[model samples]
Target: MKKALRRYWQTDFWREFFDTFLNISDCQNQPNLSHWGRKISVLLKEDPSRLRETCRLLRIQDETILQAPSF
Candidate 1:
């Protein structure tokens, strides 16, 4: 049950992230958001722990994303 909840929330999370990314990127006229968004999604799936580190690195590459990864 706990694992199922985790999976459900994970799916919800990626969906929300993609939606938010597209909305903000579209507003800013960003063409590279798709690439970055996919990168983040994959990282979240592969290793939630490392996602924050990855986001930090990506922030260095592009600080446009107003919100950074949370714990």
Candidate 2:
């Protein structure tokens, strides 16, 4: 299950994420940006450990996110 999600991590899900993230340059997109931010916050809060898997799957370079709780 994890492998499959990682394999398609760059699909629609990531596309929307990157689009919202990259749109930070525009003030008008603040709503969209905050939406994603809240969503990420909720997910991380639910399972901090998933942060590491998320980083690995997304190829994120931030080591800080890996400090999430386990199990």
Candidate 3:
């Protein structure tokens, strides 16, 4: 599942969407942080509104982290 999500996240659509989202949300500044804590803090601090907006746009439901369903 994790591997499949990594694959999906590497796809053009997801990559482009992520890039555009970060650009618009001003998250491009902290690209080096590989940890979720830093990423979440940046999201919640820098642009919480945009974070929420992007989350909605990405269709991330509550209490969920995206994972590709097994075949």
Which candidate gets the maximum TM-score versus the true structure? 2
Q: What's the TM-score of each model vs. the native?
A: 0.27, 0.38, 0.28
lDDT of every predicted structure (CA atoms): 0.59, 0.61, 0.52
Instruction: Give me the displacement of residue 28 in model 1, in angstroms.
Output: 28
Local accuracy of candidate 2 as per-residue lDDT tens digits, 1-71? 23434425336656777776666777654745577788778756687667777767656433434755567
Compared with the true structure, the alpha-carbon lDDT of candidate 1 equals 0.59
Tell me the tens digit of each residue's lDDT in model 1 across 21-40: 66774545654767767866
TM-score of 1: 0.27
Clashing pairs counted in every model: 0, 0, 0
Sequence-dependent TM-score of model 2: 0.38
The Cα RMSD of model 1 versus the native structure comes to 14.1
- Largest lDDT belongs to which candidate? 2
Q: How would the candidate models be sorted by lDDT, starting from the highest?
A: 2, 1, 3
lDDT (Cα, 0-100) at 10 in candidate 3 = 28
Candidate 2's clash total is 0
Instruction: Give the Å error, residue 7, model 2.
Output: 12
Residue pair clashes in candidate 3: none
